[model samples]
Target: MLALVLQELQKSKEPLSVAALSKKLNIDQSALEGMLDHWVRKKRLIENNAQGEMPANCAACSGHARSCHCSAQCPFIARMPKTYSIAAGERGTDND
Candidate 1:
């Protein structure tokens, strides 16, 4: 199941929110969050907090990288959700 989560992130070109991912994978949101955190600790995934500038690949961004002017508090940007993406340049990870 953990591997599945990684695979989905790898497949996506854009970062995905836990809620959207859990719905796609049919897993409970809380369970999905635990899996995401595990990958983050392993450095296989990067958690995008969405509390500051948004990444270009993030679902919230309108295709603009780093130049986002989002507020520090994400709640103000209702569409911006906490998201995750594959860690850049991570290699040889045993995605068990």
Candidate 2:
């Protein structure tokens, strides 16, 4: 089930909401939230504020809020590089 959800997220260009994901994948909301929270903690997924519920200054930028200048400078607007998950058995080479 996680694999299917990951695939859907990978195919999407924009951030997906929990409701949309749950409906599309036919999964329970609580279960999906738990999975998403796990990924967020693992740094495999990011949560974006949609309604300004969280203070803008408290937002994460590269895992730290201090790294960004926030409203005063707005220097943290650069796009983040795409992230991906690798299978557990994959071996790393020197080139990597």
RMSD of each: 6.8, 7.4
Score candidate 2 by lDDT.
Answer: 0.57
Candidate 2 residues 19-96, lDDT tens each?
A: 888888999989988887777666566665422433332434434543444645554555443233322222122213
Please give the TM-score that candidate 2 achieves against the real structure.
0.52
**Residue 2 lDDT (model 1):** 95
Cα lDDT of candidate 1 equals 0.74
- The 0-to-1 C-alpha lDDT of every candidate, in the order given, reads 0.74, 0.57
Deviating ranges (above 4 Å) for candidate 2: 50-96
| lDDT accuracy of residue 75 in candidate 2 | 41
